[model samples]
Target chain A: MSAPKPSDLAFVPFVSVENMMRLLHRIGIPDALTGLAAYIEEDFRRWELFDKTPRVAAHSSDGVIELMPTSDGTSYAFKYVNGHPKNTRDGLQTVTAFGLLAEVATGYPLLLSEMTLLTALRTAASSALVAKYLAPDGADTMALIGNGAQSEFQALAMKAVCGITHLRLYDIDPKATEKAMRNLAGHGFTLTACASVQEAVEGAQIITTCTADKQFATILTDNLVGAGVHINAIGGDCPGKTELHRDILSRADVFVEYPPQTRIEGEIQQMPEDFPVTEFWQVVTGTAAGRRNDRQITLFDGVGFATEDFSALRYIRDRLEGTGFYQELDLLADPDDPRDLFGMLQRANDGAA
Target chain B: MSAPKPSDLAFVPFVSVENMMRLLHRIGIPDALTGLAAYIEEDFRRWELFDKTPRVAAHSSDGVIELMPTSDGTSYAFKYVNGHPKNTRDGLQTVTAFGLLAEVATGYPLLLSEMTLLTALRTAASSALVAKYLAPDGADTMALIGNGAQSEFQALAMKAVCGITHLRLYDIDPKATEKAMRNLAGHGFTLTACASVQEAVEGAQIITTCTADKQFATILTDNLVGAGVHINAIGGDCPGKTELHRDILSRADVFVEYPPQTRIEGEIQQMPEDFPVTEFWQVVTGTAAGRRNDRQITLFDGVGFATEDFSALRYIRDRLEGTGFYQELDLLADPDDPRDLFGMLQRANDGAA
Candidate 1:
């Protein structure tokens, strides 16, 4: 009848990279990491409720782009992540991502946000949370191998969530370890710059392997890892991209986010299909053993999962109310009558023209 | 290394709904439709060059949400769309979509645009482009049944691409037909609002059945369709959502986009799995017959596919340069050294603080 005014439902909140940074700073990084850990832990406690599917991926010669989607019946979330190691040579991030949360009932997007930062945070939180269950009791020092983008977050998340306060960092490139040392400077960890991966693992109760190479090279050998150490393997995440030796995988008690996915993307992909591994959620739910003995090696084959992204999305959505950390995007066309889309466009032309 | 300065790659161009509408008005709807049809035709000509996947779907009790992804080697695109027919009763669109294009090499997003408008245009363009090949020669009038949201776009696309100058429209609801007629006014098409589907199909060489229901109700029976007519069957784009009677499909020469996807989502889903149908690209390539003789019943069972969205995205990317119809968004977190992600976030904190 008259010109259609846009309904409130037409707007979806978007958190840009700037807003994501501000949100992290506003909440403080340690607090954000702690908050994310809680969310991740809560989701893991009810893991069976999630609709988990292996990420849909498109692989190329240089990289892989993946879409990870999961729903908790009422809410749905998906993250678009691309890993291009060569991108850094062109001054781009090795990994960049964005994600959205939507109401499953209406299929309307509730929030769209930059996920590059969030993914880093969630990966760290997940590693530390798994370490909380799998790492030896009184675990304090963590040897963070491959001191790249994820190193400091892993160090700080371990401190915030798992009561780990000491760190030993190493990378094939010395500059990466230097970068991580500089970033984790203000954080409350006794940081160490190690000469080699062997030196980094010395006297460390936890070993975090997060190398950026897209190859199957061994960052950790079986002999280097002692009987009682917990391994948080983060970088060996894609097919043909693994960091630990198959010998290391054979001796350690491997735990994974989701078995079907980890078998394809985790370090344990080197193992046969029927090789034994425990679901990390099962350990969280007390249905499976985590750290079985003082001398037993616990390995969290930490390939990132969709449910963690879902949790991060839920956390961000919950924190968005009156935060001024988001902008409303007019992403959907809202006509006066749903069936009169053309009429709506015509009126806009008439009004604008 | 110095703190990371934001790179040009950090930003992605975003076209909002208002901007998309303005872009449509800037390049008149007919020209845009014609342009889209050209892009679709060009892509169809080299259809084998694109990497296609059947859309990934999440079905609910009432509707389904789908992700349709495709790549043309150099670039990639995916559309996020939802079909909730009952949404109209709440004054919401049954289908709302947005899509993104990315560099295949780096997996960096090149463009993020509202595809609600674009999908409408592309779907119509696809139907009309197919009609150009399949419709009987000298087809001047199209019977546009189900005068709803997509009706006007289909009518105009036919006029712009298929040389159809007259539209005979009908709907179950009188108000819908009135809305479509009102929107089509001032356009060049001679529009008639018919009281019934049979009346609308009378004397028309092309019939487009596009109704929005979640069931197998027949909008076109075997007796209603005459020989030598082309049928552009849209709207029956999900499981159990056929608009034509089974007997009509038995007699018509059904052509579809990507048989693997069409066999599950198109009107052909109503037929036996072994029922024969031609791939539409074969007809475009002249490997198969379109409208071989005047008495042949050619049906284009249009279940929206991913490559068409890729074509629309490519068209939008080509048009975005120098148009100033988009805004750059900091959707990606770019670091100076791609591996120093933590350093980038730490600097963001330092600068902002």
Candidate 2:
């Protein structure tokens, strides 16, 4: 007799890029962003329960590949991500990613998904979630200083999570601003394409710097930032890649997610080893102060933590439950007899005959 | 009026479990085992160039999940594997795995393959490769202890790589030995099903111990082991898990894959922190001796290493070139302009329409 087919336990649910987009569009980008933010906030409220570790990175001559892993008591998650700044010249993305979630009890994978789009979503949602606890009162406008791949996501997430309806967009390449403006056209935001960073931050209460240079290039100087503004610094995520000037970081009361990671990868890398900063999770849990006065500068030095990716993976797995948007991938080998794995392979040969 | 399809660069070649078995069968198990051994030997010869790190592990109460990553400057690879001994009670394999290969220059993944079968092949190949260097001259009979999933592969690899043609198998459960003997009926071998470990090792020059237990249990006592024998210790691969008696270790000249890892995971974990052991690569490179005389026992403390998986991955990627044994997975997001990721998401809506 031919070998029996692999059991259902052998298959893992996989969400390809196309399916991820369909799921996002089905949920609507704004609603998905808000939903992701809710998960991030919930995870943050119980942040002490997570097994937090800095991402494991292997740096090559041109770029780096990293594995960011974290786990709650019940589930474990990891994202495989790479960043190569020079890829853009070859018509390739500077960043790409995929991720997996597994059951802690059995150590069996539950879901696998393309994390490129999901990463962009989670990063934006993380920023918006933190803004809810840190931004100034009546913050209705945001100055988006880097109009690149992440620009439009940041814009929409802000509008969905924090009710910001106006965006001032700026980029070194004017085409980038045009691209962001075009992408965000009908998203119910009043978009202004600005010529310079100074013009973008003119009357905005939230200034987000997200340029994509590998070196320390100042996208926001001290003069461009004002008091009572929440600075969402995104581009300065790797060591030696800060975007804001030292003067701005010096003046702002910085908030960070996972201090050990932010100390190495965020804009706070320029600060002293012991330069005091409040953990954002504490603020979410109402233990730490945020935006104490109208003149207080609350800067969220966001470097994108593993817990955020864990929250994102959990959110997608929950949302895709009955959607029929994923394919079952035969990624595991399940043999009837646990001690007979070779028997399984031998049977496969007979089946082939 | 519609968005263009994702470019070929966005697609990654994926080999599922079915295709992996197909590829192995197409190559033939004997030849594939020998081929994998050659690759492992070749990589070990140039071992100094590799970036090696002990696997990053997440240990829960039931089992452990690990990420083993390594690079040879040109390419990078990692395997995600889990070992939950209790999974067998729930009709799941105790171990399952998948792996990926990526370009170090571009940080883009090239191949994703199910590594459960490949891991088995590589482990057996690694054992036989070491046996070639350390097994006694004119050795032909192998005492295969613990007739589990890896038993047949080990038997075949020794035949292919070391010209062994006889097997003496024993397990605590007689049914396991019956299964192994039945599976090896067609393969050319003089199979002897032994009731006790002492009976299995009689007149045998090579002894392979591969039991599946999560705690320390002696499979081979010192009195049962004779002179001029090579011990392929396979299953004592984690902390708190060991198979051989301490007396046997004291009498053998131990060799290991990577000391930092083997010290914690291999049978040598029973030894002291500063215990002297030879690096196996040194033996392969002629810097250290393998077998000295007819009376010395040589033990290969084979805690699986990342480089072996790297070799297996490289072998699969090379052999699958013209086989059409893989499917292209849309795992990456590629936009016309690298900065237009949001635009790509927005245009997917247009394409859907």
Candidate 3:
């Protein structure tokens, strides 16, 4: 007799890029961003239970490939991401990613997704979540210092999660600023195309620096940063790549995701090894203070963390049910008799014959 | 105008379980086994060039999930594998896996394939490859002490790669041995369902122990092993899951792949630190000797490594060309302008409308 057909356990739920886009649009981007922020905030609040590790990176001359993994005892997730700043010159994305979430009990994958889109969403959600906790009350206007791929998501997430209504966008390339402005046109925000970083931060309550340069160029010098503004420094995410000058970090009451990782990859990579910083989870847990006074610069060194990816994947897994936006991929081998893998192959061969 | 269709760069070739079995059967199992052995040997010979790291593992009460990643300068490969022995009780395979091969320069994935079958094939091929160098001359009869998922593949690989044509199989459950005998019925082998391990080892020139128990168990006792017989111990791949007895390891001239990993996961984990073990690559490179004497007990402590998985993925990638067994998965988000990802999403939204 031919081998029995594989069961549902053999198939993994796979969300392709098209499906991910469809799902986000189905849920409404603003609502999805708000949902992701809630999930991230919840995960961060219980951060003490997570298995956190600095991303395992393989660095080359041109770029880096990394595996960021985290576990919350019941579920596990990991994202395979690559950052190649030079890729844009070849008409490729500077960053590309995919992720998987698995059941911790059986060690079987539950979902496989193209995380290029999800990473963009989650990174923005994480930024907005932090801003909600630390930004001055009723913060509305923001300066977005990088009008690249992630800029629009940041702007919308800030608006949806933090009630920000105005965006001042700036980039070295005029075309990039024009692209961001176009993308945000109908998104219900008063958008500005600023000529300089100095002009962008003029009357804004929040400053989000998200440039994509790989070097340690100071996009936001100490002279440009103003008091009472919550600075979300995102671009300085790797060793030797800090967006802000050292003076801003010293002046700001810095908050970070995970200290061990932030010390190496976040903006704190520029500071001394023993530099004082607050873990964001502590602020969420009410163990530490956030934005004590209006004059205090609460700089969130927002290097993307594995837990954030885990939270994003968790959110996706939750939203995937009852939705026709995913495909079942025959990714696992589930023989009727688990011990008879070769026999299963032989039966397949016989069926083929 | 509608959004431009995704380019070829946005698609990653995915080979599912059905296709992997079809590909293997199309190539012929024996030839594929030999081919995989060749690829593994070639990678082993250049072992120094690989970025080797012990698999990153997350351990739970029941099992472990692991990520094994390696890069050989031009290409990078990683395998996601999980071993939950209890899974077999639930009619799931004890291990399931999937792997990806990507170009290191651009970090763009070239191929994604189901690896549960590939893993079985590779492990068997690796065992037979080692046996080729160390087994006594003109050896044909071999005792396979574990009749689990990997047994028949081991029997076939030995026949294809080394000139072994006879087999003696034994398992704690007599049904397991019966299953193996039935599976290998017409595979050009004289198969025997031995009553015990002692009966299985009778007059066998090679003894292969591959039992899968989470705890330490002496599948092969020191007194049962005879001189000049090459012993391949494979099942002791995790921290506490060893098969052979401690005395047998001390008596044998041990060979290992990547000592750092082998020492922690191999049968040699029972032995002390700084135990004398020969790196198998040295043997492949003609620097280390195999089968030094007729009476010497040569044991291959076969713990799987990332480079071996890398080689398997490399072989799959090379063979996937021109084969219609793969489907293109829209796994990457490729915006027209890398910096205008939001604009691309907006255009996709417009197209959907």
Candidate 4:
């Protein structure tokens, strides 16, 4: 075969939230989560190839906007996400995001997709991937605190990843719990709306805290957490915003993704500088222990990381190949002669002359 | 008029590279540069309203990929840009970029446009704006140290912003000088292609360094300096990159975009931590002195900041309003019912439901 023409080169495919939801429904949510989790693990194994940095955040009085970027030698990916805690009151999501994946060699965007829905899916997949190593064997019950837009995702991902069959949900708003219940209706999980955080955590094998608040509100107390229960903290992901009590973090065996970032954004921010924590990659690579003893409480301080988004984008791109589910965006120019950008414009002005 | 429905909300319009060039050609480059510079100056005056952050960058061995994001209270903007010094050898532009503007309240993307061309324009406009406040009286002759894709824009912006009439150009490649000469034709600038860097700098009151090499190469030395030259350093924008000799920085007064970022990425990176430098915004806001004496050498260490792009996006959005130059992007969803994101999938499945 001869060299491919510039136009023949594969442009990255994009799936909007509308199309992404359609893709998930058509492929089935469990299968999508399974595929995403597998990709996340594979990417983690070759972590040395990635250029990772802590996210750059712009803070405001109401919320924060963050740019999380990461790259392997061949591909680069970044996500634009914002957290506005008061958004739900105005009928908007507390978190909304979109991302781009590009070729590293040419610096061309291959895929641009709405990350709002994908973020929820990937965060849940990441949580469940960690729970597989940190949760107790044959874990089936999970306490999901804060049943908002992400609650159903966490419940479904845990079901697929850890075979969890029972969910005890708690939230400050009864309407949010009802929405989560309605959304998960026929998703094959036994749901219980708990009266308080303590009721939700009682006897659960795993606990996931994903409450959306911009302040340092303690959603999980040390008294509520039990031995051998793995806690997945997702929402406390910026400086001045945290969900877990400091005492809860002190007693648990902490695991994190990218220590420098976790030190600032994760629940571990409350602890001392020398706080002992295991990087999740080392545990996944079999270099460190995950759930050491049945009595030890394990915590996956899951402030969403760029590497997970990289893996999720890879999985979505691969799965959508030949599926015809995405549209081609003119994100990068394919000039007949790349040197003549001005010439390309002149031709475009003359109606694609 | 009644408030528009969420689905009918006006998108902040987009301008692609082709459309942007057409807009510039229609409005004329001088008018656009002058308008953009005005918008930048206005934004600099209200610097405290912006949610600003240092760019998030992923550096590879050969180049760098960066995401610069900023927001006013109403709109959010971000630009994705890449710089590969060796790209020209492969017939590619050294810099390529695109950006997005979004509505803050609804988290809806208002515009997506190619910024490879826009970045060149904005960088030059920002440099000219700084030189307006920092350069000596009636500055006309400018030394163009790198005659690459950015040289013509810098020349034109200086003409528009500071009434620069003469340009002395030099580059390692003679073909780059030829390209710049061709692009600057009919732009009303007296251009001289010099054989050496020293020859280019002779008697020039304003010097712009825009070399593409990603190294600590000193393009300007102490011996070449003049008494009142306003040096606009454009290419030494990332870590481990510097353009001016440390001796020159020690003697000249430096002005920067953001202090924390300038300390790491600008030519000032070669200086000590305690080295005194004034922020350009402070000078614009009259909080700091710019060019205290006519004989003082001043440097605008222009390692392009996010706010400039924010202003550029705002300016383009305003100009392209009635000019039918933008295409609507289906980047965000406006579901009839926000809660029915899952329902949208079912409708798509049913086809014309």
Candidate 5:
């Protein structure tokens, strides 16, 4: 066979949040969620193919900005994300992100995308995917404590992935719960707005806590957790920020994305350095057990990994192929004679002059 | 006065490369170059106020990808750049880049820009700024030994900033030299295309080497040395990539960007770990010696730092304020209610329904 031409190389397609929402609107959210979950699960099974590293974080007075980069030999990906919880007061999303996917062989960016919406979707999908293996059999009801921007996605993802039919929502802000209720109204799920975290967790099989505060507030104390409940800890995802109390984690069989990063940023940070935890990939690969027994409480200490972003990026790139919503950006220079980049500029100048 | 409300915070302007070029074309490249030099010098003077770190790199099979992040309390910036020398063979530029500037207090991305072109301009401006401080007085001739895409920019920046009026250019690829010659025509500078590196360096006050290769080949050996020549080593910017001979670096007074990074990626990478070098910021701040005398050879190992990109970004942001060429990218979510991000999707769904 002849050598593959440059044009034959895979080009990573980018999707802006607007374009992504449009695609989701066309494809419908449930289908998108299902597709993303499938992609994520397939990637997780190939655990050792990835080159993983703890995200490089730069801390400042107000919040933190991080670069989470990973590669699987064929492709490289990274997310540029920031967290400033106080941003909500200023009408800004507490988390904003953008990321790129590049071909590892050529180091050429294939996609440059707005990742804010995709991040929410992927985070929820990851939780639901893990819960498929870890959650108790026939789990239907989930307690969504700390209802916020991500609560609706979490609710829908659980419903679409793990057969969750009921959502017990509670939030310190009544408006947050109301917004979630309204958002999930016609999604074919029963929603009950509870008065307290205890009320929300009382009879639910799965508990998801996704608060947006940038602190170590224990949104789920040990006394509130029940037996056989699978806790999807989503929001407490940075150094000095946590949601589940140490006692709750101590009693649960904890699972994490990447142990090295989760130990520093996840709810598992409250545990000791030698605390035993399973990498979610191992469980996905069937190398480790997810839930030991029906009475055991399981915790997925989710801090969002680069691998998940890579999977989500690939999914979006594949899904948005013929969609016309994405604008062609001249993000890279494609000169007829690449070494004559100076000539390209000269041609532009000549045309103008 | 009462504290300004959160909603009253000013929106930062963004400038993409297409719009930045429009701004440059309107103001003229000469004026933009002058303005960029001023901004770079000003930022260098206040270097201590900024938080600086060596760029984080992810190496792959074909090339390397890197993230350069820095902040100055009020604003944070990071650039995602990749270098794939083999890319030129496939009709793509060897390097591609983009960056972001964000507000520190809220962690909101203020600007997202296409930096592929801006990087060339900024790298040239930074090298020239260093030459202005380190090159001896009355230096008006430059030897550009690598006549690739960046060679003309280097030549022009040196001419505009250091008053260099004559250029001797050489490249292994004769087409590249011809391209540089064409690009430099009518740019108010005298130029000569030479046959070899030695011919290019003959009797010149400054020498710039910017070859596009990812290896440790020594383009400049001790035999080509001359006194009082300021060497701007541009392309030896990654580990295992060095253009200058060890003896050249050993004898010359080397000025670098961040010392830790330069030690690993610059020409000094060939030297011992303890080799002493002065950071360019010190020379800009007048805290260290630049050139002791007219006969002293100096080398500005131009590895390209994040701070220079920060300066370029700020300059572009300021200059492109009124230009209508930029499209408002929906890169960040500005939810009416920050906690109701899911509601935005629901509303979109409702509108479609």
Candidate 6:
């Protein structure tokens, strides 16, 4: 009962893309989404305990790679994610991510997992969780603008977490909407493919904009949106990339993930620096108002905070205890003697030689 | 003519610690150290091309976990590392690291390797590389303080790159020095285990301090370090953890990795904010003086820069093409139709079901 063996420390559990997909299906995507939303909600409730900062971003000519790190006192997590709009044209996913969760006491990685699928899941889960507190009561229908890689996840997470049963989707390209329609086929929802944003939002109480253009172009103009509708804005996530007109933001009471980050990357970037906004966690903690009235437009401008990723990782880690969806990776070098790193190398040479 | 398949895109080559040791043995440790030094030298020569930022650190009651990220436009690399002083007491490594290298344009990781061994290799490479420029000519003996995990690597790198042939080691714990002596037994050099710091420094032209402590420390005093000698100060990396006294810094012209990071985390942290320091790259680029005279005391105040990690990763990546020491892990999610991430997951679920 003295100490754990050093070789036992070499293994860090890793969930690959294939394993992540199996885990998602095994738990059922709907149940997974709801479970993930619970974790997100729990973390949001104790948001003050987190170390929050704007993600460190490295911008390039065609894309950006970002490292989002956060920690509670007990655990630390960071996500390595990249966004390249042109990647689709080259037959690659626009986003591919991986993340690690570590023990804060030892700074050792406990889990390393492919985050591309998990990120899409968590980003949608975050929206659904926020919608629970901000969306108008009895909001059963959602209008999904921009049907792309994340559209189906967005639709299902909202259905499972926010009780939105009907899905109306629209995109500038008919093929994107057709693809999304096919993916969500027979998923227990009444799905509609609309021609324009106006047609998509016609009978919807919640509108979600997730366009992917890295520009200031507006997917939703002021005239197109009516009052009493909750907007879950997920597409405008980087500087100079926005989906809604400034006029809509002026009229709406905006809620964000983290202010310093969302101010630069969210739709509210078009607003004045001193513009008033409420952090969504404050609403979760019951300190801030959410959906003051049915007629009041509530906007959740989410850039996807690090804590949501941390929550998703924490959830996956807890779920991996008995599940066979993870592989123990030889990620860290643990010498038999703590100070004998070179001796470990020497032994490896002897074994290999 | 067609796009790469999704499975192919998901496979990222990973070199585990055992493979890293195999590669080092294949390349020979001295040559590996020299090869890594060349890459480090190359990167230091064009230091401005890199996007240099201080590491994002998360401090806890126990230790710190840091993400050091840097990009040179064509490629991006980041190292995840942690330092916990009490880890050794629990039979865990005090420092453990892993890193990834990616294509800057696509943001796809090309290689993921265990950097605990690589960092140890690269830190020694950096010291020896700097010693090539700053250490006295024909210097053959080095006094190694704190002969712990990094001691033997430092001694060998100095032998390979700086032409040092003799080593004098000292440690408060004789067991650490004994461990180093055993690890470096077959390596070709004259080894001397000294009793004290004064005994260790006698007739040595180079001095290396690589201790592991969490508080303010003076491993090297002012009068103990004389003129015409080069000092590679590594252990004094974190805030409040400095190896040399302020008087030693006052007498020596310190060259640091990155000024912003060094001013906060290096030995220079003990000096005033306005204290004069030179970036080591200027000397590499021949824009600044390295060893001005035989009487000058030069210090390479290296707090392990991100570029050195980048270079080590770059080197390991290039060396992995034909080496059978790498495993391709399914680390990314790539959908055939880039817009249909749900379709990919659905197919995976169907296959698994």
Best by DockQ: 6
Model 2: per-residue Cα lDDT over A45-157, one tens digit each: 99999999989888886888999988897899999998888888888888899999988877778889999999999999999998988899899999999998989999999
Interface RMSD, model 2, angstroms = 1.4
Looking at model 2, give its docking quality level. medium
Q: Indicate which candidate wins on lDDT.
A: 6
Instruction: Name the candidate that leads on TM-score.
Output: 6
Query: CA lDDT, every prediction?
Result: 0.89, 0.91, 0.91, 0.81, 0.83, 0.91
Clashing pairs in 5: none
- Clashes in model 4: which pairs? A12-A110
Tens-digit lDDT string for candidate 2 (B1-353): 01223377788889999999899999999999999999999999999999999998888998888899999999899999988888777778888999999888888888999998899999999999999999999999999999988888899999999999999999998999999999988899999999899999998999999988899999999999999999999983788999999899999999999999999888988989998899999999999999999899999999899999999999999899889999888889988899999999999989998
lDDT, residue A86, model 3: 89
**TM-score of every candidate relative to the true structure:** 0.97, 0.97, 0.98, 0.88, 0.95, 0.98
Clashing pairs in 6: none
What i-RMS does every model get?
1.4, 1.4, 1.3, 3.0, 1.8, 0.9
Location of the lowest summed lDDT over 10 successive residues in candidate 2 chain B? B1-10
Q: Residues A128-245, candidate 3: write the lDDT tens digits.
A: 9999999998899999998899999999999999999999999999999998998899889998899999999989999999998899888999998788989999983778898999
Better of 2 and 6 by DockQ: 6
Model 6's i-RMS, to one decimal, reads 0.9
Cα deviation of B278 in candidate 5 (Å)?
0.6
Find the 10 residues in a row with the least total lDDT in model 5 chain B. Answer: B1-10
Query: Local error of candidate 5 at B226, Å?
Result: 1.3
How well is each residue in A84-189 modelled by candidate 4, as lDDT tens digits? 7765555555676788887787666777787877888899999999999999987899999988667778888899988999999999988778877877778899
As a TM-score, model 3 comes out at: 0.98
Q: Which pairs clash inside model 1?
A: none
lDDT of 5: 0.83
Put down candidate 4 lDDT per residue, B169-230, tens digits, no spaces. Answer: 99998877887777676778898999999999988999999886778899999999989889
State, as a TM-score between 0 and 1, how close model 2 is to the true structure.
0.97
Candidate 3 chain B, which ten residues in sequence have the lowest lDDT sum? B1-10
* Residue pairs clashing, model 2: none
